[model samples]
Target: MFLYTENFEGQKEMAMAGLSRALAEDRVDRDIIPLLEKINALDNYFTTSSCSGRISVMEMPHFGDKLNSVWLGKWHREVFIEEVFEAIGRHRSGQLWFLVRSPILHVAARTMDDAVKLLNLSIGLGFKYSSIKSVSHRKLLVEIRSTERMDVPLGEDGELWVSEEYIGRIVNLANAQVRRFKGKLKRLEDEIEVLEK
Candidate 1:
């Protein structure tokens, strides 16, 4: 048997409550809900946060300025080139960027052994960036994440730098990435029950 962190049950309960609230508010990603439910059903784990990956066009005051960033368009599934153009049309005064991010899940494990088991499983499922994020008597956190991503600068200050052809090419690439990660998520969801053994 594994030794769990102090107040692990209490923490799991609180996390579940938070997840319920997020669901009620439509803040949780739809594609990731089934996977999250499977993980949460286990005795040793509960998810704290997650994203089912996304393709987005964003505007920011400057590079790496997340606080001032505004999303012109965001999609959890694959997108069309025309949709991309529409988002670009909304861009005003800021640095515009096109981005694709892979799926990420932050899980709180009941113990270090559980954490490592989940981390290894996630890495094997193509979440190459999976790792133990933090360890303490209060919590053991694991980050399950993939490496597929793209950050392309589109323009600045209401200026368009890339052509429509260029945007089309990047849109194709982003869609491919979206398909790839969705496959991985499916595999992980199918295999998650193995952790119980």
Candidate 2:
């Protein structure tokens, strides 16, 4: 996937470009409306932070970097693989985790690897990201987290963490996962049936 950023484009617009690219790919067969919803959840964070007053356009600069860049990273890009990137030197690496329990995901995930590559990274929804460490799954049975990026305490350098909120926004991700899963399983079942014929 390629990255595209515009001077005046908004977050949704930038995300839509990625969504459109993903949707237009010939390799993507099944519908992605549900997955798109999951993607939209990411945008919700912006609105929530703004409304909750946890974030401000003025304070953003002190917290994160490059808030104005319109990122157009591919679904499989790794520039922002995880909440943070680890690795000495100029290279940084991170992990992407999602609940594959959804039936739809089962199908779409047939050819997918355990991890997703992300790029066109953006920071600043109100959090301090310095010397990013690791991106591991949270302890929740059905939820996930970016172990590295977190909310800092009263005076700490960084301690911010995104969990319940992120999970809540992505509640429907499982739907697509389930749908894809079942679809692929059905295809396999159909192949078996054809083989018998």
Candidate 3:
């Protein structure tokens, strides 16, 4: 018999409620909604958090300083060069970076077996960074992620470092990454129903 974590049903309920709240607030990524819903519909899995990935221009005091970081501009879809320039224009202090991140999904599984199954599926679907995030009596968490990412330092303080042509080049690259991940997300959505079986 498969053993689930203690209060698994209760935790799933609470997580569903949180997802509902995020949806109502428009805080959930639009592209990831269908995938999250499908996972939540399954008996053994529920998404705790997800991002369909993003391209952004950000300002921070230093690298990895998320607490003080500010998004000068962010997009869930392909971005244009003009949009990037506008975001860079807003950067006044601290480090400026052009970033691209692949889709990420955090799922809570009912059992360790369920977690492993999902993790393997995710990795097979090109989420090479997928892994079992945590394991305990409380929950088995699986993190579905991809390796596509870029962190290019644009400038610091009020100075501009790169030329417009450089920005344009990165914009094209970021768009390509966005298309690649979106394709992966689509494939995952198509295959996720297999988990229900």
Index of the highest-lDDT prediction:
1
In order of listing, the candidates' clash counts read 0, 24, 0
For model 2 the TM-score comes to 0.21
> Which 10 consecutive residues of model 2 have the lowest summed lDDT?
48-57
After superposition on all C-alphas, the RMSD of every candidate to the true structure, in Å, is: 1.7, 19.8, 1.5
List model 2 lDDT by residue over 62-132, tens digit each.
33433632122222111222322121112112212221221212111000111111110111111112121
Candidate order by TM-score, decreasing, is 1, 3, 2
1 against 2, candidate with superior lDDT: 1
lDDT of 3 at 82: 91
Distance from true location, Cα of 79 in model 2, Å: 30
Q: Write the per-residue lDDT of candidate 3 for residues 102-186, one digit (tens) a residue.
A: 9999999998888988998999999999998888888789999999999999999979899999989999999999999999999
- TM-score to true structure, per model: 0.97, 0.21, 0.97
What is the Cα-based lDDT of residue 103 in candidate 2?
20
Residue 155 shift from truth in candidate 2, angstroms: 19
lDDT of each: 0.94, 0.25, 0.93
State the local distance difference test value for candidate 3.
0.93
Among all windows of ten consecutive residues in candidate 3, which has the lowest summed lDDT? 1-10
lDDT measured at residue 87 in model 2 versus the true structure, 0 to 100:
12
